[model samples]
Target: MLYTPAPLHIPDGFLSILVSVVCWAITIIVIGFAISKTNKALGEKQIPLMGVMAAFIFAAQMINFPVAGGTSGHLLGGALAAIVLGPWAGMLVMTAVIAVQALLFQDGGLLVMGANILNMGLVTAAIGYGLYRSVAGQSKTVKLTVVGIAAWLSVMAGALLTSLQLWLSGTSQLEIVIPAMLGVHALIGLGEALITVFALAFIIQTRPDLIGEGSESAKASRNWVFAGGIVSLLVVLLSPLASADPDGLERVAKDLGFLSVGQDAPYQVIPDYTVPFLGETALSTILAGVVGILVVGVIIVLIARGMKAKS
Candidate 1:
């Protein structure tokens, strides 16, 4: 069976060429600015931080937790990334991760990569962080609450934008898709909130130096690197247990009878997140997960290092 590129992202045949082009245009514009801002904001030492963070996000997204109605959701990583790395840098990291997912891992559509990045990266980094900063204030307790709320709302906002894109593409009616998408994603959003809050809290406690202008000591940074390794290992070991149920968008598409509208791309290097020549096995999945994490980390590190050089 031909699968849509990513579980939650809008894929190939689901969107019209026009909608895809528009999404691409907007993504390009925003990413250009994101690159500029990240270059100016991040320093040489911070590159490794961003690199490990991207790897952690990539690995974390591999585990899909079960939700209601046989739907599942994974970490969108926008809110967590923004809170840790600052918004603009987070946006660039997400863009790189999504691009690698599509190009090398084939987790998302190559053609619709812009839309995937825009929805999952730009929207969350811009609107989600804005909401979080506005409401979080300075108190640590308030910040935690606001991050959770902002993370939940960011998932919903991304869902709403995706639904609107589908509606515009004539894949489904706005009224029908809107309610279905929002309803399923509401539960998914809760998962996002809880996970984001817990991760943020952990960082605050263990690596408070990583936040804001705080400096990370050599030991603390090493600990973070170790943590990233552990997270990646966990993703590889636990991904086999990820729920087999359809994710939020896939579930909505099935319910709305628009699932069949998805089109296969012209070519696939590693389609459906599966590694070719390995067959469908636990080993293959783990290998693919590891490969994706490494790819995302290496790409982001190279980008950051290149920028640091230029500066």
Candidate 2:
């Protein structure tokens, strides 16, 4: 039987309606600002770059690597996105990825999506870019070091925010939840850092112009776009090999006795990343992942192009 991956994000009923609403309000405001900022600065090449980044991030999130104590972790990709696309565009890319996960794959809950987007997308991008901008003219070694730190901190920030939301929702006490969430995520964050560092290192070595302020004037290259598409497809093809272990949040929730609080999605599209007709086979997962990347990539590209046109 195909392994059913545990929910990688906050599911429905994890937060009270009031907290969820508040998060929604905050997220909408931040996303509005991001759109305005990106509209003013988005370059022609960056439009397709946004799509490629979103596709890669979406594909990367599908494969969960094992961590200590039977828990697993996946790339959040905010740092990498921000480092490559700038924070505003990075936020947009992350928003597209997370939205697709919830709406298409039911990987995250609809009710808590605002918090998810805020924690995993907006905040991460901000932290990543904020820290990274300090080392703009540094060497590759220094840049990678900062990126790794930023990536790890981004994961910690997401965990901390999630813990707070859960506490505010009365799901757990602040003291207990904070430590539990932070402790496991600390290890998970290492994986995030390493993956981000390696990816950035590759980009820096091969296509240095694709990152930094220089990217604005970097001419669009079909070769880069095609290579990125192939990489995303390859990641999807490897989805079947992902570790069958509970993710950091799921592990923490189960340990804290709030695992039962997670509510099922009201509907299913390709629920749990498996094609319904295929009945939970590895091929089903690969196909579903392919569909997911394609949809998210197209959505982000369209949104970016629209913003570019407006600008």
Candidate 3:
């Protein structure tokens, strides 16, 4: 069986080179600002916690839940990251995770990596975090409700952007792609919302310090070992149970007759999140997921440490 990344994530050849280049330029500019912001705002002690959070997000994203009508959607993690690590630092963490997913795990194309990061990282993180901030100072139930709504909105926002990019690339018509993408993503967004709320509630109970002061700054934690271990186990164990149904984006693409637009990457180290030696079995997928978690964790730690050093 051929392997493709969950969520499709704007595979290669679906976007024009011009669009890709523009997305890359914008991503670089925004991430530069994020790096500077994070450097000034993040504490030295929070570096390791950032790594664990990244790992947790990475693992959570691997658990794709089934939506209605034979479709699935996974956590995008932008809002969750922003909620836990502030918008700037969270964006940086998300960018690092997506970059590793594309470059090392082959979950997204290198060419379309910029677009993926733009859709899933910058836009979602900014909008979700902004909405979350707007609803602050409410009751816990209200805040969680608002977080749910923001999470849903964030997924829709990314879906809208994906549709627009696909339309611009001549993959699908705006009339057809927009509604299809939005419709499926609307449901997907619910899953994102629930997961975000649940995860946040768990953290609030177990480690409120990670949520920090005002979502713009965080308190440090030395207990990341337990959190990281739990996340690592989840990635290794539950990833094999991810739904086989096409994700929201892929379902829309197939239903809209644009699925053929995707092309294989020029090269892949671990194509479709499967280990080469393991040969497309459940074990291969689990091993790949574990490796991805570790890679993302380490990269986030290094990035956080660098930001701390610069500060």
Candidate 4:
């Protein structure tokens, strides 16, 4: 193994059903908030983009980075979305992906949806976005170096919070979990930073028209082609990184004795969600990411066409 995996892949038992329910309720409220970010809110044009963003994150999530000791983790994508879409909309997109993974793919735990959202959705979309904006506000385009650094920092921060959540839930000792989770992720965060910078750069170059404020917001759709092309490339490049070791969460749980506590989710993916090959973590993640991006791109196009139809 290369590292310990801490990505949210198991079902919940570390916490109670009540916790999951509360998180789900919170997810719903956040989604509602996200929907309100659109120019027309729930208009037909926005629905497609919303759905597409969900799929994009879903796909992006499949590619996990090898952290310490060969342990692997997935991409959270909140930062990317928040950079492109606003935080509220980013939350909506991220929640959709997590929800689908839990219900359809059976990836994340049902009980820890709140934990999942907090770690991936809220942390990345809200906190990460806040930092990015603070450094390079919505009006400014950060140098790729600056964006990469920010992305890495944002990912590191999110991983730290995930560990904290585990500690708070009594799943693992905070002391041990904190270092184990943060240490590995700090490295993985670089991968995130590189990918994020690349993606943002491509988008800006191809669709400079689609990125920013009023006129920019109106033109953002024009850059969909460039964005879609980037998606295709990411899908192809993503499958090679899955590590063989259990992730940070699993390692901490096993070491800290919380592994025995979380309800065992039936392992569905062969080699489950960590292998990088065609059968293991890598192949599935790449496939999932490509599928997700296409799904989102198609949805966005449909929405655009629909809005034009309505107009």
Ranking by lDDT: 2, 3, 1, 4
Residue 282 lDDT in candidate 1: 40
Q: List the global CA lDDT of all models.
A: 0.66, 0.68, 0.68, 0.58
lDDT winner between candidates 2 and 3? 2
After aligning candidate 4 to the native by TM-score, how far in Å is the CA of 14 from where it should be?
1.6
**lDDT of candidate 1 vs native?**
0.66
Q: Estimate each model's TM-score.
A: 0.64, 0.65, 0.65, 0.59
* Candidate 3 stretches greater than 4 Å from native: 1-4, 64-73, 215-311
Model 2 worst lDDT run, 10 consecutive residues: 237-246
1-311 in candidate 1: lDDT tens per residue? 22224446765777766668778999999889777866776678767877787877788876677766776666778878877776777888888778777776677687778888988887776644554544332678877887887788677767777876776566776556766777777787898888888888998999987776333343433333343333333332322222222253354444333333332222431244332234345455456657977886676456445633543
**What tens digits encode model 2's per-residue C-alpha lDDT throughout 1-311?**
12233333888878877678778899999899888877777668867878887998877776677767876666779888877877778899999998887887777789889999988887777667755654556677987897888888778777777876786576876557766776777787898998899888998889977675544332332222232333233322322222222253354444333333332222421244332233345345457657977986786466445634543
In model 2, which regions exceed 4 Å deviation? 1-8, 43-48, 63-73, 214-311
Clashing pairs in 3: none
